[model samples]
Target: MISIQRSQHSPIGLQLGPSSATLVQLAGSRQNRVVHAIAQEQFELDEKQSIEERDANIAAQIRQILSDHHFKGRHVISCLGSQELFIQNVRLPQLPVDEIAKVVAWEAEERLPYPLAEAELRHLPAGQVRQESNTKQEVILLACHTGILKRHLDLLEQAGLTAVAIDVEPSATLRCFHNSSNDVQTNATNCYLNFGDAATTVIFADQQNVLFLKYIMQGSNHLDHAVAENLDLPLKEAIRLRKIVTNSPTLDASDELHRSVIDSIRSILETISTEVENCLRYYKVTFRGKKLDQLIVTGNESSPWLIEFLSDRLSTECKMGNPFESLKCWPTSTSILERPGRWTTAMGLAMKEKSNS
Candidate 1:
């Protein structure tokens, strides 16, 4: 656990995930940075565990990760992933900055699934949109259950960490590749596809800021389960075999087992591809954004085959997203570089400066 070293130091990034806890600490200034991130499987809880038991188990897991890594800084910026969030892209008539929140609350009345009173709501400006001759401001309305947020904070408290801010995973992901489209900012846009465990996040942005965001409920886990069912293997074994097939660029088509695994996951692959198409089409038609220059892929389960499938479907170039740019790293942190994409959210959280928000 890295200790906060006055104002000049970056706060640690602590991502409290359902199955894993990722912690990252960034050292140095904006241009020159060094980062070390660790992702540890947290304690698995059964339904029988009481709330107190669950908290203690989870807190211990968080502490174990910190102790094993010896990362300093208890002050951290954390995030709420898709499962705990409800987000919508809505268009609103222009209004004074002071009155925007009120309008968002009103607009959310017809959109949010839950009563507005029971939710913690926040709105972010997603730039302007024009339809026919009318112009409206596009906003991303975000909501999380009040109790869910309380539990999040409670976990942080139990783990002896200070929450400088709470961020949504999409925001953290956007922060990781904000500058990805800068080179082609004037003519083309960049798409970020963060293939998470339970959901795949889609963000359309260019150079400086995020223009749109959406989530697909189906994620890499679906594919794993599909393979598991087909091979009659346990999930752990299925995941290992699937990863081996995906990581191997020269996977043998003649290998009967590998071929069967690929065949099993075809449906989920098609579903993800369709979702990507819908997101891209919506962004183009609504935002009137430029052509997509490239797709920036991330997440632990992302594969070379998935990238190829997407790239071919959209007729756009694709590549793995890289957030590490001028950062010095310790010799022992090679794993961070090896699977950097999986730690993108934590890295982005580490980059976020301290704020009450």
Candidate 2:
């Protein structure tokens, strides 16, 4: 139900997340590319402001960001978090391409949480499934509440911008990895883990298409909160200490504070590992012969310790994902690389133009 209009100019990419909004503008062809600007603004909720007023304020902030960056055009492709959308994989009998949509709508009526009349549904044909006597097709179904979509559209309209298409975070994250410089093994299955402030999304895929997706409510913020509570430190200080411990080679056993920090971080890592293991187990059961080849972690929460911990626990090769690896940018774009993981969704949204072309 998302409409995408291809334009001559580069389309702006926006990711409105629970904690912040990230916007990226890219121009020129891929070979002569220039990453015009990448900006992120954290939201400060005011209890006194009504929902409308708060949205208007955020729109005002977005306008200022675009104006200061000298970005052109008001059209953008945005991404919604998995928490805001309903995604499911459905299997249906083989049918003509034209009939697929109609069948999917009927199926969605029963499966979607929202009323079919009040939801905008979209379907992507994943692939075909072969049975002993017949063939069926697998489809990825995405449904969003009409109110949620309208709210986003209204916010962008108030910001003097138009949203051309809205994408899910998991798909956008997959786009980042697919377009990265890393060599993807065609025959091997891979899992992409997007760790966000509110949730973590695990996407099972290969070089071509997504095989499965699972959302875990636990995220990097949970780890930060745990560290803060365990260490009896302020949130900011706990965040700093987490980074220090994660990046350090080893904790000082003689220091009680160091030992405590280590223990807290390990506990959170163990939780994350367990969740990932469960997903992997399901994947294995569903796709008997297939094996997960590697794991790619991305998002603002990804760190050295997280990767190392998951690698050891999952017994799989794990690495951090870099969204900027394939793009050429101006000198000012260096700042975008600092938190490359945070920009994956936005960067992937920006790549829609090229991908479609």
- What is the clash tally of candidate 2? 0
Instruction: Estimate, for each residue in 186-212, the C-alpha lDDT of model 2 and write its tens digit.
Output: 567889988877788888886647777
Q: List the candidates' TM-scores in order.
A: 0.88, 0.84
lDDT of model 2, residue 183: 68
**Which parts of model 2 are misplaced by more than 4 Å?**
1-9, 128-136, 224-268, 329-335, 354-357
Return the clash pairs for model 2, or none. none
* lDDT against the true structure, each candidate: 0.76, 0.77
Q: What does candidate 2 score on TM? A: 0.84
Q: Candidate 1 residues 229-257, lDDT tens each?
A: 99899888888788778775555789987
* Residue 313 local lDDT, model 2: 87
Q: Please tell me which predicted candidate would have the highest TM-score against the true structure.
A: 1
User: Which one wins on lDDT?
Assistant: 2
lDDT accuracy of residue 280 in candidate 1: 82
